[model samples]
Target chain A: MNQPYSSALLENAVNEFAKLPGIGRKTALRLVLHLLRQEELSVENFGNAIIKLRKEIKYCHVCHNISDSDTCSLCSDPNRDDSIICVVENIKEVMVIENTHQFKGRYHVLGGVISPMDGIGPSDLEIDSLVKRVSEGGIQEIILALSATMEGDTTNFYIFRKLAPHNIKISILARGVSVGDELEYTDEITLGRSIINRMPFNETFKP
Target chain B: MNQPYSSALLENAVNEFAKLPGIGRKTALRLVLHLLRQEELSVENFGNAIIKLRKEIKYCHVCHNISDSDTCSLCSDPNRDDSIICVVENIKEVMVIENTHQFKGRYHVLGGVISPMDGIGPSDLEIDSLVKRVSEGGIQEIILALSATMEGDTTNFYIFRKLAPHNIKISILARGVSVGDELEYTDEITLGRSIINRMPFNETFKP
Candidate 1:
């Protein structure tokens, strides 16, 4: 029964495809089967592309983003703002914000956030490079567009402490209840500049 | 904006990823980013898998199905009925029938059909090997398990004509109303077969 069909090469291909998110064993098998069905040319294209990816792509040292070469285009751009830097936990977030067409400032991808429980502290991130960039003294403000989560707040605070001596204006996205009427996922707040503005949390609190 | 992300390497990676069915530019970007996020060891494993897929994997000469080595396991099997060949248009269909465990016969993967519109004729298919196998004269049956489509029928008829000289009991999976479907989707005689056989379609028609 084992020898009736399904060679180990096909099995290995299925296993590799199943490692991808949202792909189940049946789908993985289907994909591998599709690859097997193709003529030599299509299969060759798939194989060659993957090899090219590994051989050619590298990291942008300045922004710590995935790139084809040493310096990323964003870092090399002369028209981009040097004064304002948008700090994000992941390069994924940078793309998301960029899609909104709202942020004109350049980015500083931190690689990851400060999650001590996950064994990812500030040192594990690209925080040192960020500090060095700010310390060079031309940067005016740092906008933290990190998710409104505990780890994001922690990383934001850590960056704030490191940047305070440099006399830079720090900003975070404003938070109140969201516009969409949905069930609240979180009430955890860090109250960055919001505390200074002073909102009454308790309904019965006297003026 | 065009030059904002420049690299033949990155472009090639994205282009290759984007070529996959249903994958878009955004998703391709995300996949590349995910690869970049993985540790070097893990990325190496991914790359190695692709390399192995390209270099190590090859088609079995006998069945023309993908295999790691010379002959596919089915063609090499000792107990399977070499006399009874279940001919299929593609290797994917082989798994579909094999999963039923009913088929104890060997297979002749046709590679593809006789689609004149697509410039694929009987000569393009593995019909020559099949004729040679038949001409050698030990084989008993060739079950034409091609799809119910027009091209499949055309290919099956052509093979039947070629195989007319040989004495073989030719049978096909009985046409029937597909399981778990409404009566409306059924054509009359196919529905008749469902009522007549009445066991599961996979149980009997399979193998």
Candidate 2:
């Protein structure tokens, strides 16, 4: 239904909210109305937060991850391993990996994978910078922690080929049933891969 | 899970977005990322629209609906019936009624209903203004078009008693099965009410 918003200002705000992903006009209206009820300073702070982030946000010069300074905190931290680099698609993946606390290596954010369907190529990503980082030498291992999708596989293969001549170890995330998944419910490919790449019984069993 | 956002700016924006109703941290991150991908000018416009709206929006002095000016377009329009007023809970109800293309009378927005559970009373709403408007004379009828909840009924009764002194005709919206609702699926209370308040066959029948 066409909303006859009594105020043009209200309509404009709603339109702006509706432009966001997954927010429709009805929900946009609800969000706008909620904001309208808030204290003016709080709403101003909300608006300014978004504007300031877009205007002043920086990217890590080394890894291409979003950063507050020229070099991101993750890349500059002395405790993180400088010899191994974990490669991922974007800043979000970096956050997820960091939360896991399993990988202590520095990150190499590719920005995005090679998805030709969306017209994204290797040049569109930070692949050249990744190669440069590897060529500069000290990184002994490159961990390719990308998605399990076809595009992720294609990108992983491409990156592997590019870094192959450098004679460094290249690895991808292990493909297997999730920790809590029932063996009967596991997909054939994952189950097969889990068997093929199975660890020795003594290594996995503590008892 | 704790998100280790690489940039403070990104984290701040996501936190602000997460403050909105129904939006969680993960969804907030997605929205903030989406905004980051947009052009600087567009993102600025998004921020400016919300700020400008909150900073500049006005309320109609007569009807209390959100307006660009002191007098809303609906209250100022000469074509609408000045003798009748439709009392609604908020601006959204006014839009819903307007979209139906049925009501041509002026509207009085109550801002909210009398919900003692929420600490809202008659004084908290525009009920006093509504009573004052009626006491000033010229209004022949007042239609109570609030929600179909207990709070709505209580507010309607309160307003009915307040307007009883003014001696104007007071009415309410018809409660019945929805237009497309099946009789079997309709609740007993609604079915009973529809039966008790059944309309004259000829008055409702166009054919």
Clashing pairs in 1: B103-B207
What is candidate 2's TM-score against the reference?
0.97
Could you tell me the lDDT of residue B199 within candidate 1? Answer: 74
Query: Which residues of candidate 1, in runs, are more than 4 Å off?
Result: A1-6, A29-57, A98-102, A115-119, A148-154, A157-167, A173-207, B1-7, B39-45, B48-58, B116-119, B177-193, B196-207
User: How far in Å is the alpha carbon of B10 misplaced in model 2?
Assistant: 1.0
Candidate 1 lDDT over A1-207, as tens digits, reads 232335666667667766766667776676666665566566666666665676667778887766677987777879888899999877667667777767777788898889988999888889999999898888999998888889998999999999889998999987664545343453445333435555666942643
Candidate 2 docking band: high
What would the TM-scores of all predictions be?
0.76, 0.97
**lDDT of residue A41 for candidate 1:** 66
Report the lDDT tens digits of candidate 1 across residue range B93-188: 888788888789888889888999999999999999988888888788889999987899899899998988787777776676776889987888
- lDDT (Cα, tens digit) per residue for candidate 2, span A1-207: 799999999999999999999999999999999999999999999999999999999999999899999999999999989999999998899999999888999999999899999999999999999999999999999999999999999999999999999999999998888999999999999999999999887886643
For model 1, report DockQ: 0.24
> Could you report the DockQ of all the candidates, in the order they appear?
0.24, 0.88
